[model samples]
Target: MKKIKTKEAVGHVLCHDITQIIKGVKKGVAFKKGHIVTEEDIPVLLSIGKENLYIWEKREGMLHENEAAKILYNICKNDYMCPSEIKEGKIELIAEKDGVLKVDIERLCKVNSLGEMMIATRHNNFPVKKGDKLAGTRIIPLVIEQEKMDKAVEVAGDKPLIKIMPFKHKKVGIVTTGSEVFYGRIKDTFGPVIREKLAEYDTEVLGQKILNDNPNEITQAIKDFINEGAELIICTGGMSVDPDDTTPSAIKNTGAKIVSYGAPVLPGAMFLLSYYKNTIPILGLPGCVMYAKRTIFDLVLPRVMADDKITLEDLASLGHGGLCLSCDVCSFPNCGFGK
Candidate 1:
């Protein structure tokens, strides 16, 4: 019985008899480090509750649209989806081309049928570049199956998609227009809603003023708030195409440049946006946003706070998912179209 001591182990070929393993794994199979002994070396390596051992080579960066579609279509690769369940947003089929396939969303969603329905939600016709997360079909209800996801990627023959970024936050100001709120015709709810939503981000409330919709008063309010150190000034009400809708006039009177007078978004089509001397942002909110759960304000607030340059092209992009369906079940987190 010969024993290999620690001192003698340094310069020795302890196991020369071991063979170099060349096992065939599923094309895009992966395994984390410190995983348990493998039953077979064909697919991904399994982690034994210690998942930090191996570095999983995940697909990274933005991907092209056709490339993403191909990955999505591949969900039905080899495994035939039930033909009957092909409609009703369930059971999808994709054809392979150029060594790639699209992810199968409907079929994957139906087969699992327990967790939140996974969707390959992507940016709509917005000219996505290479290595972008075009569509993410969340099949395991809310949970994404890592293995299945990797296989899906392999079938798609593209890199992993990096998550899209959300708008950052900047200081904002609120100017509640209309004599109704000033005169107590209705307990002002708009101000608080705007405040709460903005508070959810990294922004500060620069200033606030409750003024009657008098053009001069509103105009002065805009100047005072801007002078008082407000970067973004939002004037609620007085946004309609009526005589009393003095918000537009007041903002213009402040010598502010109107970026957009009306957006195509529903419940907020009458919304207004302006830049005051290029130093501040002045917004005129329509009546619908006063009590509406989600409005144009919500859609544009993040962009304003992030100091993003909003263009006509950007506003035009909101049409695809701008209307709030007001579904019985609050599908906010599940759907980001309006947001």
Candidate 2:
């Protein structure tokens, strides 16, 4: 760093903040550190009593922190995401649409491991609304070696490290099982809950079937919904491993490949997921989904709505951070229920 006349400092980066005092009115930074001096800023510097300023000398192989932040943004940007204006050597990514946020954990970790820079992001596979903050990027020092940022770009490869999978509008069907609701023994509460949840997405409920515990009837109901062009089918109740719990078998009877019949998540261990013709999804939700504030259903719904495939490994991975504390005042998605 070297001191130079404020008039000659134009285009040079400030090495320290220029404080301005307005007697009893104000006292604050008139020019922040790292601010590139401009012709228009000379008067303000003079008014702040700074006849000369210390500035960082431009180096051949180093990039300013703002430049490094843009490099990190490039590594993470994808469709359906927009970058915030670079400010104070930092940048943030915001979602341009409601969608599921997907993070490349392996690549993100690799980039962060490079050190001197960082990209902090929200948990993967979670839902984000338009304008929601997705990730932030910045460098540790006021300036960094351009070579380190180059290495980060190389590690990120051609594909970005983060993306927003936009939700697709789906035609859905609901199969409500269990004789208690089927025979009018109890008012159907599951159907309403499922409908309300689906309402959050761009989904059209094709129809819902109320059926007894009979496996054959349940299987035919699922087939009927598929034949009617339902893209997704949800089977509520009858997911437990009991003699009468036949939702799993009914889904299998449709010749749909079962992804998994169980998950490690609590309040949703009996959850079942299958795909018909390797396209349409059929889920067997546990009883808890009808009552629990947040279950495996809430965690998986965003991915399903986004038309992203769920695999056995995906279900197995939910074991960590899967248990819902069931706080008296639920703050799901924002909380660590499924993070």
TM-score of each: 0.54, 0.98
- The Cα local distance difference test for each model comes to 0.56, 0.93
Worst ten-residue run, lDDT, model 2?
330-339
In candidate 1, how many clashes are counted? 35
> Residue 32, candidate 1: how far off, in angstroms?
12
Per-residue alpha-carbon lDDT of model 2 for 179-288, expressed as tens digits? 99988989999999999999999999999999999999999999999899899999998988899988899899989999998899987999999999999999999999
- Residue-wise C-alpha lDDT for candidate 1, range 182-292, written one tens digit per residue: 999888888887787777666788867888878899899888878777778888888898887788988899998888889978779999888887757788988887677
Best candidate per lDDT, number? 2
Off by over 4 Å in 2: none
Candidate no. 2 TM-score: 0.98
